[model samples]
Target chain A: MRVGLVGAGVMGRVHAAGWAAAGAELVAVFSRDEDRARELAGQYGARVVGSYADLLREVDVVDICVPTHLHHDMALEAFSQRRHVVCEKPIALTEAEGREMIAAAERAGVRFFVAMVLRFFPQYRLARELVAQGRIGQVGVIRLKRVSYTPNKPGDNWYLDHARSGGMIVDLMVHDFDFACWLAGDVTRVYARAAGDRYALATLRFANGAMALVEGGWANPPGVFRTAIDVAGTKGVIEWSSDATATIRTFLRQPEGAAGEVGLPLSPLAEDPYTTQIKHAYEAIRTGAEFAVTPEDALRALRVALAAKESARTGRSVTLQGG
Target chain B: MTLRIGIMSAAHVHADGYAELLKQIPDVDFIGFSDEDAQRGQAFAGAHGVRWFRRHEDLLAQQPHGVIVCSENRGHMELVQMAAAAGAHVLCEKPIEVSRERAEAMRDACAARGVKFMTAFPMRFDPSVREVCARVRAGELGQILAVNGINHSENPSGHRAWFADPHLAGGGAVMDHTVHLADLLRWFFQAEVETVYAEVGNPFAQGTLSVDTAGLIQVTLSNGVFASIDCSWSRPAGYPRWGHLQMEIIGERGTLVLDAFAQALTVYAKGGARWPEWVQWGSDPNRAMIEHFLHCIRTGEEPEVTWRDGFEAMRVALAAYESSDQGTVVRLSP
Candidate 1:
C-alpha cells in the first residue's frame, strides 16, 4: 500500500517507522517546516510535498500525524478525496468533529482507522481477551496509570495548552479511557479532578457496573516513564506494570553541555504496538476486514474523555446518554 | 503495675489478630474478650482459650486499665461508651462509628470520663510508612504536590458477612478502606481535606450487594495539595494476602513510591493452592500500634492517634459517599 505521512513531528517520525516496518511504500511526506519534512522524507527515500493536498493526492492512504487540533480538518480533506485515512488517537478534539469525520468516511466509501494503539499492545490486548473470556469473571474495578515528563517543556509546547492538545486528560489519559471501555463497556458517568495541566485523576462508571480510576500525569521526573494497569474481577485480578517488565537497564553519564531532553522508555519488543497497529490497518484495508478500533469506537472514547474534561472543569460528574 | 487490656468484642476480622498480639505484648495482662453474638463469642473464646463474656458490660466489669473495641462498625460506639464509663482507656477500631453524631458522642463520653481514646490506625505505626512520613516532614522530598494512595483487599464478606451488610459495616469498601489513608494524609501533610469527590459502585456484587464495593476518591487538602485514593474490596477470594497499601507522593524536589506491604516472600505451596501466596515478614504494625496504646495508658499520656483523627477520617469517608450520591464535590467546613 502507498502511504503519505503529514506533520514531521515526533509522532510523525514514529508513524513513519511504523509504516516502514509494515512494508508500506512511504511515497511522500509533508510539513509546514520544509527542512523537517525533507529530513524525514530523506530517511525513508520518500519525496517532500509542499502541501497537505499534494501529499493526499500522491498516496492511497493518508496518515494524519499532525497536532490534535489539525486531525479533523486533515482527515476530512483526505476522506473528501476518497483516500483511506489513519488518524492518531482521540479521533478529533470534539465529539462532533469525530462524528463528522466518521460520517465523511462513510460518505466517501473508504475506511477510517484511529490508532488507539493500546488495543494493539500485547498486555492490554491479552487483558481484554481474558476479561471477555471470563477468566477473571465479571469485571469489577480497573485502575490505569500513565505518567511521564511533559511532552515538551511547559512554555514551549502546544501540549501544555488545553485548547490545542486537550491537556493531559484528553491527550494522554484518553488511551486508558479507551482501554477501560474496551475492557469493561461503555462509560455511563465520569468524575474527574485535575491539578493544573500536569496531572489528572478521573473515575469512570462503566455500563457493566465496573468502575475505573484513570490517572495521567506529566509530572514525572525527566527520563522517567511509567504505565500500569490493574483489573479486578469477580473471580480474580490481573495486573501489569512497566516498572516490573523491564528486561534492560542503562545507566550512562550524560555528555558535557548536551540538551537534557526526556527519553522515551523503549519496550524492546520484537514488534512494537505502533507497528502492530499499522500492520493491522494495512491488512484490514487490504481484505475489507473490520478495523480493530472503529470510528464509532474512537468517538465513544472521545466522548468519555470530553466528559471527563468537563467534569474536571465543573467539579461534578458528567453522565453520558444511553450509558 | 501491669497494664490490663480487655477485648470488647470479636465481631471484627481483626479481633483474632489483635487478641494474639495482645497476648504477646510485654507487661500487659490480656483479660479475655466479649461479644454480642453468643456463637461467635464462644467460638472465638474456645479457639483462643480465653474467657468469654457474653455481654459487653460483663467484659467492662473486669475493670481493665484499657479496652480494645473490636466490634462491628455499628457496635463501636456502644462498646466504647461502656468502656469509657467504666473508666478504662479505649483503643477502638477505625471508623469510630457508623455516623458522625455517634462518633462525637463516643468521643464526649470518653472525654467526660477522663479516659484516653485512641483510634486504631496501624499504618501510622508501620515502620516503612513512618520513615516516609518522617522524610516528608523533614523536607527531604521538599514541598508536596500530590499523592496517590491505594488500599485494596479481598471482599471481607467472604469471612465476615457483616462487612457487606450496610447496617453492620456502615458502608462497604469506602467505609472499610478509606480511613487509614485519610488519617495518614492528615498526619503526613498536617492539613485538612477541604473537598472530596468520589465515584463509588458495587461492581463485585452489583445485583446482590446493597453497598458499594469500590470507590475512587479525590480530595483537595487545605495546603493546596491534591490526592487520590483507590479504595476497594476488589481482590478475589484466591488472592495471596488479604490486601495491600501503596502510595506515591509527588513533591517539588522528588517523588517517593511506597509499597507498604511489598516486604513479603512469594510462596508456592504444594497444597490445593491455585495462586502463589505472599508471606509478609515485616514488622507487625498492629503489634506496634497496640504497644503504643499500652504505653499511652501506662504513661497517662494522650494517644498519638486521637479520637479526632478517627473522626476526621470517618468524615472523609462519609463525604465520599455523599459526593458519589450527589454527583458533585462535597466541601467540608473547616
Candidate 2:
C-alpha cells in the first residue's frame, strides 16, 4: 500500500521509519516548508508535495503528523480527497474538532484511527488481556504516573505552550486516560489538579467501581525510566514492573503469598508500535479490518484530558464527555 | 514447627536487626553465620551471640529451615540460592538482587524448590501502613488517586563506603529507598507501578556514595494513580539514625497523610553562631519489624508481610534504576 506523510517533525520522522519498516511504500511527503519536505522525500525516495490538497489527491492513506491543533483540518482535508486517515494522538485540540474529524471520516466512508500506541505496548495490551481474562479477578483500579524532564531540544518547546499542546494532559497523559477507559470502561467523572504547564494529577471514576489516577509532568530529574502496573481483585493481584518486562508478580488471596507470572506477557511484535498501527491502517483499506483504536476512542480520551484540565482548574470533579 | 535460621553476611546494617529478632524469639535459633570478612563475621557473631563460620557452605550445611541473606547488595542471589538449594526457605534483604533478570531467576529458583523465598522488607509491619491498606481496600479513602512518600535520613546512605559503588549498592538512594516506598504503595493502594520517570543523583555525599545520597522517584502505578517519592540521606548529622518516613494518600473522598515513623517529640536548640536551630526526632520501626517476623513464624498462619510484599519493594528499586538509565518513564514488565 502507498502512503503520504504530512508534518516532517519528530512524529513525522518516527512514522516515516515505521511506514518503511511496515513495508508501506511512501508515495509522497508534505510539510509547511518545501525544503523540509523535499529533504525527507529525497531521503525516503518519495515525491514531495507543497500543498496538503495535492498530497491528499496523491496518496491512498494520509497519515496526519502535524501539531495537535492542525490535526482536524488536515484529516478533514484527507477525507475531502476520499483518503483514509490515521492521525497522531489527541485527535484534535477540542471535542468539536474531534467530532468534525469523526463525522468527515465516517461520511467519506474512510477508516479513521487515533494513534493510541499504548494499545500495542506489550505490558499495557497484556494488562487489558489479563483483566479481561479475569486472571486478577474483577478489575479494580488503575493509577498511572507519567513524567519526564522538560525536553530541551530545538522547536520541541511548543509543547510547553498550553495553546498548542494542551500541556501534560493531552501531550502525555491522554494515552493513559484512553487506556483507563479501555481497561475499565467509560469514565463517569474526573477530579484533578495541575501546576502550570508542567505537571498534573487527575482521577477518573469509571461506571464500575474500578477507578484511575493519572499524573503527567513535563519536568523531571533525569536518570531512569520507570513504569509499573498493580492490579488487585477479589481473588488475586498482578503487579508488573518495567525493569523486568517478562516478569509479573501475582498473589492469590488464600495462598498467603504471590508468585511471579509465568509465560511471556510482552508483545511478540518486534517493530515499533507505529509500524504496526500504520500497517493496520493500510490493511484496513485493503481488507476492511476494524481500525485498531478508532476516532471515537481518541475523542473519548480527549474528553478525559480536557476534563482533567477542567477539574484541575476548578478543584472539582468534571464529567466525561462522550462522542 | 520452629524455624531454624542462618545468616550469610554482615555487610548490611540490617544484619543487626535480624540478629536481634532471632534473639527475641524462643522458637528461632541462630544456626550459624558465614562472612567473607572473617573478622567482621567474628565480631558480628560475638555481638549477636552466634557462631561464625569462614565459608558460606558451612552456614548452608547447617540445613537450617530458613536463612537471612544479608550480605553486600551484589551477593544477595548467590546466598539465597545456596540456602534454597540446601532445602531452606530464604529471606534476602531488600534491594533484592541488583538486576531484574537475576531477581526473577532467584524468584524462579525458589518457586521450583517449593521453598519460601522472600526479600526482607520489614516496613510492611508498620501499623499505620496496614491501617492504610485496610481502609483503602474497604473504600474508606474512597478511590485513591495520588500518593507521596517522603524518606529522609540523617547522613544519607552514601555515608557508608560500600554504598558508593554502583556494583555494591545498585545506584544510590533511589535503589536503596524506592523499595520501601514502592512496596508500601503497592500494599497501601493495592496498585502496581505502571510507569516511572526518575531523577537520581548525589547532592551531599561529595566524598562517600557512588550512587546519589539523595534522589527522587515520581511514578505512575498500574491502577492509574499518580505518585511521587522524595528520598535522601539528607537529615542533619548527630541526630537519630532510624530516618523519617511519611505518606500522603489521596482518594475520592479524602486525603490521608500518615507519618509511619513519626516521633512524638521534637527538640530544637539554637546555635551559637546565628544558625538554624538543631532539631531531633526518634522512631521505632525496627522493633515493630522484629515483632512481626517472629509472630508470623510462630503462628504458621499468614503473616502481615508476604513474599509478594517483598517483590513490590524490589520492583520499585528496579523501576528507579531503569528510569535513571533511559531518562524517560519506563513501563514495568508484564
Candidate 3:
C-alpha cells in the first residue's frame, strides 16, 4: 500500500517510521517547507510532492500531520480525492468543522481514522479491556494526569495560540478526554479551570454515573513527561504511573482469591505505540475492517475538550446536549 | 518565663498529637484538658496524666497562660470565648468556625479581651514549605505565576465522626482540608482570593460518604496568581500514611515544588497488614507550631497564623463550596 505524508515535522517523522514498520510504501511527502519535505522524502526514498493537492492524488492513503487548524481542510480534500485518511488528533478545532470532515469522508466512501494513539498503547488498551470485562466492577472514579514541558519552537508555534490549538485542554488533554470516554462511556458534563496556558484541570461526569478527574499541564521543566491513571471501582482499583517501578498495580477488595496489589507485567510488543496505530490503520483499510479509533470517536472527544475549554473560560460547568 | 497551656477540648482528631507535643515543650506546662464529652476528656487526660476538668470554667480556674481550642467546628467559638474571658491566649484548631461571621466574632472577642488568637496551620511550620516560601519571597523564582497544591488524606469519617457532619465541620473535604493550603497560599502570595471556582465529588463512597470527600478548588488571587487546591479524602484505608501535602509554585523565571511530609521511611508491615506505611522522620512541624504559639504569647506579639488569617482562609474555602453548589465562579471581597 502506498501512503502520502503531510507536514514533515515531529509527528510526520513518527508516522514515517510507523509506515515503514507497517510494511507500507511511503510514496510521497509534502510540507510547506520544501527543505523539510525533501529531507523526510530522502530518508524514505519517496517523492517530495510540491503541494498538498499533488500529494493527495499520489497515494491510496494520506496521513494528515499538519497543524490542528489545517486538519479540517486537508481531511476534506483528502476525502474528495477518494483517498483513505489518517488524521492526527484532534480531528479539528471546532465541532462543526469536525462534523463537516466526517460527512465528507462518508460521502467519498473512503476510510477515515483518527490517530488517537493512546488507544494503541498496551496499558490503555488493557485498561479498557479490564473495564469491559468487569474485572474491577462498576468503575466509580478515574483520575488521569498528563504533564510535560511546554513546547518551545523557534518559529510561530501554532500550539501556543488558543485560537488555533484550543489551548491546553484541546491540544494537550484531548488524549485523556478520548481515553476517558473509551473507558467510562460518554461524558455528560465537564467543569474545568486553567492557569494561564501552562495547566488545565477538569472533572468529567459520565452518563453512567462515573466521574473522571483530568490534570494536564505544560508547566513542568523541559524533558519531563509524566503520565498516571487511577481507576477505583466497587471491588477493586487499578493504577499506573510512568514514574513507578511497576507499570500497573491492581488492588482487590476481596483478596482471598486475588493477589492483592498485583502489578501487571509490561507489554512484550516491541513496536512503538505509534507504529501499532499505523499498522492497524493499514490493516483496516486493506481488509475493509473497522479502525480501532473511529472518526466519530475523535469528534466526540473533540466536543468534550472544546466544552472543557468553555467551562474554563466561563467558570461554569458545561453540560453536553447528548451522550 | 515558663508558659502554662490548657487543652479546651479533646474532640479534634489532632488533639492527642498536640497534647503529646505540648508535653515535650520544655518551658511550657501542659496544664490540663476539658471536653464537652466527659468520658473522652478523662480518657485523654488519663492517657497524658493531666487533670480532666468537668467544666471549661474549672480548667480556666487554673489560670493557664494559653489554651489550644481543639473542639468541633461549631464548638471552637465558645471555647475561644471562654479561654479569652479567662485571660488566656487561644491557639484554635483549623476552620476557626463554620462561617466567617462567627470566626470574626471570635477574633473580635479575643482582641477585646487582649488575648492572642492563633490558628493551627502546621504546614506553615513544615521546614520544606518554609524554605519554599522564603525563596519565593526573596525573588528566587521571579514574579509568581501560579500555585498548585494537594492535601489528600484517608477518609476522615473512618477516623472522626464530626468531620463528616456538615454542621459540625462546615463541609467535608472542602471545609476540613482546604484551610491549611489556603492559609499557606495566602501567606505565599501575600494576598486574598478574589474568585473561587470548584467541583466536589464522592466517587469512592457515593451513598456512604455523607459529605464531599473529593474536591478541587481553583482560585485567582488578588496578586494575579492563579492557584488550584485538591482537597481530596481519596487515600485508601491501608495507604502508607494518613495523607500528604504537596505544592508546586511556578514563576516567571523558575518553579518550586514542595512535599511537606516527603521525608519519611517506608515500612512494610508484617503479614502485609497496613501493607505500606510512611513513618515520618522529618522535623516535627506540630512542635514548631506549638513553640511559635508560646513564643508569641511570651513576647506579647502576634502569632504567625492569626485569627484573621483563619477567617480569610475560611472565606476562600467556603467560597469553594458555594462555587461548587452554584456551578459557577464565586467572587470574594478583596
Name model 2 segments beyond 4 Å from true.
A222-224, A244-269, A321-323, B1-334
Who wins the lDDT comparison?
A: 1
lDDT tens string, model 2, B133-155?
78878987666666766675544
lDDT of 3 by residue, A33-55 (tens): 78888999999999998888888
Q: Is candidate 2 or candidate 3 better by TM-score?
A: 3
Model 2, A1-323: lDDT tens digits are: 67999988767777888788777889899997677788888888999987888888788888888778788878888888889877888788899999999999889988887888778776778788888897756554455655554544354566667787777788778888888888778887676656555557665667764555566664333322345565444334455655456344445354422211111123345666767766776777779988768888888898888987886675445665442
For model 1, residues A236-297, the per-residue Cα lDDT tens digits are 89999988988887688866433233334458889988888999998899789989888888
Give the local distance difference test score of model 2: 0.69
Interface RMSD of 2: 18.3
Index of the highest-TM-score prediction: 1
Backbone clashes in model 3, listed as residue pairs = none
- Candidate 1's residue-wise lDDT over B214-285, tens digit each? 988989899988888888998888788888899988776646899999999988887834368998999999
Score candidate 3 by DockQ: 0.27
Which digits, one per residue and each the tens of the lDDT, describe model 3 over residues B1-334?
A: 8888999888888888998988888998888888768778778878888778878999999999999999888889988988899999999999889987788889888989999999999988988988998999999878887776778677777877889888898888888889888898899878888888777766666777678877777788888787778787766677778877988787766457788888999898797646677888999998999999989988988888988898888998889888877867899986
Please identify which of the two predictions, 1 or 2, would achieve the higher TM-score against the true structure: 1
Q: Which residues of candidate 1, in runs, are more than 4 Å off?
A: A153-156, A251-265, B272-274
The lDDT, on a scale of 0 to 1, for candidate 1 is: 0.88
Q: Which pairs of residues clash in candidate 1, taking residues 3 or more apart in a chain or in different chains?
A: none
Give all candidates' CA lDDT scores.
0.88, 0.69, 0.83
- What's the chain B TM-score of candidate 1? 0.98
**What value of lDDT does candidate 3 attain over all alpha carbons?**
0.83
